[model samples]
Target: MRPVVFDGQFGWLHPAAGPHGVVLCYPFGYDALCTYRGMRRLAERLAARGIAVLRFDYPGTGDSAGDASEPGRWRAWIDSITKAVALLRQSTGVERVSLCGLRLGGTLAALAAQQLGDVDGLVLLSPVLSGKNYQRELRAGYRQWLSMPAAMDCTPEPDTDEFVEAYGFRLYREALENLRAVDLRRDAAAPARRVLMLDSLDAARVDALAAHYREQGIEVERRGFDEYSKFMMESLDSEIPRAAFESVENWLAAGSGELATAARDADTHLSADDPQGHAVEAGVTETPVWIDGGRMFGIYCMPHASLVTTGGTPAVLMVNTGAVSRIGNARLGVRFARRLARQGIASLRVDLGGLGDSQPSLDTVTLDALYAQDGANDAACAARWLAARGHPGVVLLGICAGAYVGLYAGSREPAVTGAVLVNLQKFTWRNICDETGKPTVRVAAIGSTRSYLRSMCEPRKWLRVVKGQTGGWPVARELAARCASRLRATLADRIERITGLELGASEERRPFAALDARGVPTRLLYGVLDDGVEELEKYFGVRGARLRRLRRVKVSFREHMDHAILSASAQENVMSYFEDFYRSQFGEQPGAVADEPADSRDAGRSGRRARAAQWLARQARAFRLSGEA
Candidate 1:
């Protein structure tokens, strides 16, 4: 499958060498993110079954171009489905096109079928019939989430009539009103086509939806398929619903027409010159590549620059941010990479060793097990690969844990000339002791309870405190534990230094200290509301004096932005920082470098930690068990 652009939408095209084609629409918000891998797997499966498949992000979502927070996002998304179907036909020369969607995606598919008379079939999985009901569920989920201990650090805004946030997504009044008016059960007249409705929760709504289609003289089939959640859940181990997907394949095959021999002739290559994966814009190319000895996957982006191509364009490497894949939160990586390409720069947004497409099943270590270690190795490998591709002066850029990894990687790799670390929580991760006395590596939670408590000192937060909306005991216990942990580490470091003995390697392996010593120029960017701000002050001395004195480190902040940089405007702010960093790092003329042997260190995780770190495989699945942002 390859990336494609039509109108202003971004999608992946899976050529099947078949006559039938499918357009897979994804669900909205975090659901779409969590189900991204599953969607891709399903598309590949359908393609193998002799059906051309196109899965894409709607306008304002994923790598697609638009502001999701805007009022008309729903209408734009519905229109995007038609464009996708048309593009699939035009690209593959397929005579028939079908729509397959999950959750809200299914609802949008039904809406698209209503608008476009050419749709041949519909596959709706856990489709939302009533937009009002879905909105209620979203609000409830948001409220339930806010009640969790992990949410205590985040501030809640006053109830508003104009807007509301849920599961890291926002809904404006206009969008809410538009959705509330969606009731396919009563308002939608089914298109004349075969329809398959599969329900994971065994809800009566699917049955009703099917009946409505049948009443409209459309052939409808309904099935109870509860395993679909496995395909949409947040866990990396979550596999595509094999039985459910096979059922869809069989149903589609039942109506299969003459096969298209030209489908196999379609182009889907990873070369910079390949035009198959051009982004929505006219001058940007998106190439999917497998690097790091073919153990890692990434998308390389560069400007067309047909007028004047250069071999020495500066490159940027963006690692996976948290567990949100290489796209970064809110598809920040894609937007930034494409923008940089237009400025005569190249970028590679890659999934880390065991995150996103680089599944744990493909490797011995899971994301959590490799999080604190493999970053340096993976990033160094990426830098070397970029160097070989002619863009030798590479800058490392990442957010959250990605930031931590970039810092360590840039410090260790000679190819990395500069670094942009955003919302860096900690310089070192913790190693927990197991029963066998061996250490197990794991990512540490960011910020402290005391920092959260101090944040509550704001007048607005005090109002919430007075209203008793806070969980007092959990906060107190967490605060005490964090203070105790810090004190213990401080005393341990002092004792080890005075006695000339090693207590632990955590304090000894500070990446900032090493980066500062090397005089590597680094930029630190943080969101105003991010907890990492507190971590920055605690680790880098008062006002970051320890690093600022190096005269190579710079710090800046984005106002009204959260830790994840979810909003479009916030993402734009992030892009600006990326542009400035790349310009400053790679603006100079080319320089000759000395040829030297690469580091001989083992790039994989150490075996000593592997046995003890077994539990981390499960921990990475419940990735935010300790923290969300």
Candidate 2:
């Protein structure tokens, strides 16, 4: 095992024989730390075939320096990998390089390959094709968290960046926005070479994409890996798909002697505790920020360079669930912050109270209590945090229930300049079972007329009698008994009363109405296929025409793309839209922007383009509905 540093860009490098060549490997987030079975196996196989392999971590991800909340560093990540490739060539005397990536890494590799005039091959494993799809999945997960009953007691301080739950790390709005702007296929056009694509039998989209690549005359070959666990989710252990690895080895072994000989002689490597060599910079000052009366806490990411200023930069504050920290969210947040920073924009990903590293004070309140109060205090607390930082012009960006909080905050705070609500929801009901083994709606019922008459119209007395008498096998059975006793009762009336009260209370708060009056640009992003769309729309009166100037986007790509914006293709497309929107509104300036070339790789690629086009078309329809087009 050889540890190599290419001009301060650290990575794990495996050498191969014959003509020196390079293969850059990129891992999905979290997957970078937990498992590298597939990556390590591929590196060994390629190294044996004379292809040197190099894999490194993105800053604030594995072992790299800086915080994930710094959105201005995404380009830095791409630059680091590109520089690593160049350094690998200098270190090994390799004249040719092949880029290999898994998931988001595939998208990043594709982007890097497009800019570098390297004469080589490219391999993408289930690359993210759409950003909107990934965001949708993220939104869904957040909505699920919000729907849980108050008994779960899962609530983070509003405006904080971190959360702690059963799972490892959870990312918030900053991360989601950053991931939303990453796309690989947009400008990824490399010279046709031996392109190998691996797909799972169950992955119909990947299979279709592979077929499309083959038709493009790109020398593409598709190999199916059966029964391999998904590498994205943390649920899978670090187990290599041996069958898939061997297939790749066989394919490379059939290539030219230079490639084949290297494959046979390369060193066999083990999955290391940390393969990316990510290290934090020392002596970095960490400033603490308060949210929800110190119930939630966050660390501010200050600029490292003198040229980077906090002045006049549009600030974005993020919100997340109780499963991850601001740092995890920074994985995505840092990307956007970096991009925006390059454009003279600033952002902050806060740790909500009671989650991650943030410990609530005695006076700090819980999310359940805040929800009961319609999130007013929580929103004000976030606004005050920004105001103290001299960031008066702020944008409220949230995911899932975070969206709810953002809406609530934006509605109340006049300092808010804009609002980005992703996957918003109104109300969530918990399933309650009756003694008869059937699902029953849970609501407060009013006393019956007969009971009232018997009690001489004493409502309190009747209520006590019902509470004492209603015990038993099933709620329905008890209700029937009450009805038999000449008590007036109906599910519809009770439901109506509950719904009216909830809505009436919400309206009385006047948060959304205030936001509209404030003219704060509000952008609501959601998945067209999101199950919660109808539910969310029902509560927050559909702002049909209002969303146009506000810039709403509905991602319609893959049906299953989650909210994290994990899909490679979706990531690329969504980033394109994001960049376009940001540039259009913020004014594009030289040096403040990076030019991304048009990805013509799929120009001649027959089937993939057709399928992608169809998928994009469907997404386009959804975007049009939101007036994004």
Worst 10 residues of 1 by lDDT: 592-601
- Over 53-157, each residue of candidate 2 has an lDDT whose tens digit, in order, gives 777666556334554446655576667767878767876677667777776676677677777756467676656666567545444555554443211112322
Candidate 1 residue pairs in clash (backbone atoms < 3 Å): none
The superposed Cα distance between candidate 2 and the true structure at residue 377, in angstroms, equals: 51
User: Per-prediction TM-score, please?
Assistant: 0.72, 0.40
TM-score, candidate number 2: 0.40
lDDT scores in order: 0.68, 0.49
RMSD of 1: 10.7
Total residue pair clashes for candidate 2: 64
lDDT of 2 at 224: 67
TM-score, candidate number 1: 0.72
